[model samples]
Target: MEAYCSMKAQEVRKLIREQVITGQTSGMATGFTQANLVILKQEHALDFLLFCQRNPKSCPLLDVTEPGSYRPAKLAEGADIRSELPSYRIYRDGVLAEEVNDITDYWEDDMVGFLIGCSFTFEAPLLAGGIPIRHIEENRNVPMYKTNIACTKSGIFEGPTVVSMRPMKAQDAIRAIQITTRFPDVHGAPIHLGDPSLIGIDDVSAPDFGDAVTINEGEIPVFWACGVTPQAVAMQSKPSIMITHSPGCMFISDRKDSELSVL
Candidate 1:
């Protein structure tokens, strides 16, 4: 079975290239640094680059492709951005127009690619700390929502930061904060906890992306700034064109999860 194989991240990337897999990448490339992808035309690269810098929590830049280039120079070699991802979202002037498994048809000489750190990279550490993540236990993607919290605006990109939620007992929640603080590269530490309404989240059951899992009694909902914030902001920013990995579908980086350890 695919789950039984202790495969390397590179091997998993090969499968994505073959199109044998077509679904969210969450929990798949375990121990590898999974990242959120963003692509935009070169004309907006300066503004967008500044935007990411201003909103580091939501858009921690990883590796970026040069203008008009597809091959990622430092992240992955021989990696095809247009086909490696299981799915892609195409936005025109900042509106969702289509979702596809590949984007070779959408590639242009003026486009640039960006990789952002994802919370999935922290799942391993949380598990190691004995803090259970409900979504993984339920075999569903993590729940995400757009919050009322606004990120620092950069250039033409300015929008509320989105976040992913996980419920935990009070004591475990405290320990989780300590454990996750070490992994800032991936989302480090919970931003808000306890009441969702404090962050403008009305209903925890209705998630913006991914499926919701059971929240036990006495558990508090903890929120973390999400990589999706950038994508959602791009949707509202209405850039001439934008592309990003589908929700839960991320680019598997060659770096080891421990390589991301801030020690």
Candidate 2:
């Protein structure tokens, strides 16, 4: 993993494409942006794009590949969306049908791949800001939950907003908010802090997705809009076919964290 982190985004992607590194991409390719992936048929693309636009915090649009094209022209040159991510989840009629390391077998000529900004892209800045990221410290993927909060519906896409959690001291949480707010493309500032239950998260120790980490004394749970929301919405809407990077397995991009930062 150390070796991979030092490599450039394209190199990390090549390894993923060749099945050399099949694991969560949480801390990989350090300074580059990592994106959440969603692939839907061309017919569903416009509606999905509108859904993303309606819910920017959770589904920040990073890049969208043309129909049937796996390459994300703006995010990463020479990257293959179908094979670059470590894992993928295939949903049929809104239910997860299978999980695979590669989607080459399922690619369709009319499919449009959407690359949504992921919170991992902002962690480097948070770390630099002196804010502790529990998940990365624990060597685990950030915890995520499906919230009771509903997202605005667009065409056939609609579902509860999802959030990723990271527990931190109040001061650190505040600093994290200030730091993350600068990278709006990557989920941005926390949507909620202190109480997990208020956002419909019943248990802080047990996450719906990714591994749970300790919330230590004097620390509060911070929640951010998650890229997972799109996939959850797709499940509820029951798209005839939908594919997404399995939770925590992200598509690392060539774009730098500095490039996406506003200030």
lDDT against true structure, model 2:
0.91
TM-score versus the correct structure, for each prediction: 0.95, 0.96
Candidate 1 weakest ten by summed lDDT:
1-10
- Per residue, candidate 1 scores C-alpha lDDT tens digits across 1-263 of 25713667788778888887778776676787888999999888998899888887778787899888888767787777888888999889888989999899999999999988999888888898889999989988889989999988878888998999999999989988887787887778879999899888999999987788899999988898899998889878899889999988788887877887786
Backbone clashes in candidate 1 total 2
lDDT of each: 0.86, 0.91
Residue ranges of candidate 2 with Cα displaced over 4 Å: none
TM-score of model number 2: 0.96
Error of 1 at 228 (Å): 0.5
